[model samples]
Structures are given as C-alpha cells and as structure tokens.
Target: MARSTTDSSSSGSSSSSSSSSSSSSSSSSGSSSSSGCHFHYVIGDKIDKYVITKYLCSGTFGMVLEVIDEQGIPYAVKVIRLIFRS
Candidate 1:
C-alpha cells in the first residue's frame, strides 16, 4: 500500500515524529468499506485466504468442507443450520 508522508513538526508535539502511526492512516478524504457475506461466521476473502481442501462429509443431511485456516491449520466446516438463503 502506497502512503503519503506529511510533515507534522509545525505543531510542536511529542508525537510529531511517530512514523509507524502515520503510515497506516489514510491522508486523503475517502470512504472505505468491506463487502462480504455478513450473515455467516465465515470471514470471507479477507480472512487470510482460507483454501477449501475438501469435504469432510456430504449427504442429504448437509455438507462439511474441510479447509485450511488462517494459520494453514486444518478444520472441519459442517453446515449445522441454514441461517440465511438467497
């Protein structure tokens, strides 16, 4: 991510020299938001790229997808209930 550097020494404050604090902030006046499936516990694409390895189980009952978690850990994802449908 590209960042714009601004001089804040003119204010004469103790935090004027904090580099790390200013880098992550947006200097421009803009709006930012995330578009994801808000209903589900699944964090969507932003949660460290959870790769769907396979299904743990599947039948007329429901389905369970085995996935690699954020830390590359394995987990069983079973659809216990239908929270929302569309």
Candidate 2:
C-alpha cells in the first residue's frame, strides 16, 4: 500500500513565530481524516499499480474488492466510504 501525507499548517501561521491554538486542532482533525477513505474508485480502476477486479464484500465503513497487479498477482483491496456532514 502507498501512503499520502497532509500538511495542516496554514500560510498565515508560517509568517509569525507565535503558533495559533487552532493549529493543534487542525492537525488532530487531519489525523482523524487520514484513517478514512479519500476516494471512491470503482472496479476496473487502477490505483497506483493495482487494478481492481471484482468486489468481494461490503461493510458499514467500506467495501473489499479483489485486485491484481501488473504481474497478475492477486490482492484484496479495501475501499473506505466517505462521510459527509449534514
């Protein structure tokens, strides 16, 4: 699996040496979001080097699919569902 990084720092905060209290809250929210799915990729879609083949199952949080790599090696891919604020 590949990893992505998110920087929580804002542009205005970098100008001054004094850090804002919201910075900590922003970072915490960023970390929480990191655990959730950021994209809704479908079957036959290629993520990185893995190609989604078939859906295996689904749960409250996400769905699991069968996938393969360029070498045809099989793998199980879990895609997380996005939660929208109402």
Candidate 3:
C-alpha cells in the first residue's frame, strides 16, 4: 500500500501546505505526478454552499477555483491539498 502526507502551518493571516508522498514504485516522477490531485471538487460540484465553476490555477501548495453562490455572485475559492499532520 502507498500513502501521501501533508503538513500545514499558519503564520499570521497566511498558511501553507507541504506535500509528501510514498508509493510502491520507487520512481520520484510517479510521486510528483500525483501531487495536488487530492481534491475531489470539479466543475458543477457544490461545496461549502458554493458551486464550482472553473479551475483557476494551481501551485505546489494548492489550487484556486472559481465558484458561485446561490445568488450567482462569483468568488475565488482556494482548495488546499490534504494535510495529514497531527
């Protein structure tokens, strides 16, 4: 079995996500390819009362997506990677 982990810390009003992965295959490329794919949200998916609209962008930390509320007002929602740290 393989697993991945993440750690997050808050500095004042800012936060960060660190990704760690291990797999059956020893290939580093295999681990890198799976990073940031933890999120299950997609277009038309509803979460936190917001409906996912589009995938804006992504970084090593997380991804940002466009979402809309019931009122149709759009907003930028940041969905970070899963954090496994205690």
- RMSD list, candidates in order: 20.3, 15.9, 13.1
Candidate 1 residues lying further than 4 Å off, grouped into runs, are 1-49, 80-86
Clashing pairs in 2: none
TM-score per model over all chains: 0.33, 0.48, 0.53
lDDT of 1 by residue, 7-83 (tens): 10111221332322333322221111221112133323222345444433334434443445456544444444333
Q: Which ranking of candidates, highest lDDT first? A: 2, 3, 1
**lDDT for model 1:** 0.32
Residue-level lDDT for 53 in candidate 2: 61
lDDT over C-alpha atoms for residue 65 of model 2: 50
Candidate topping TM-score? 3
lDDT of candidate model 2 versus the reference: 0.46
Off by over 4 Å in 3: 1-35, 83-86
Residue 32 deviation, candidate 1, in Å?
35
> What is the per-residue lDDT of model 2 for residues 1-86, given as tens digits with 9 covering 90 to 100?
23211211112222232232223221211122444545545557776676656555446775545556687656555556678988
Query: What do the candidate models score in CA lDDT, each in turn?
Result: 0.32, 0.46, 0.46
lDDT of 1 at 42: 33
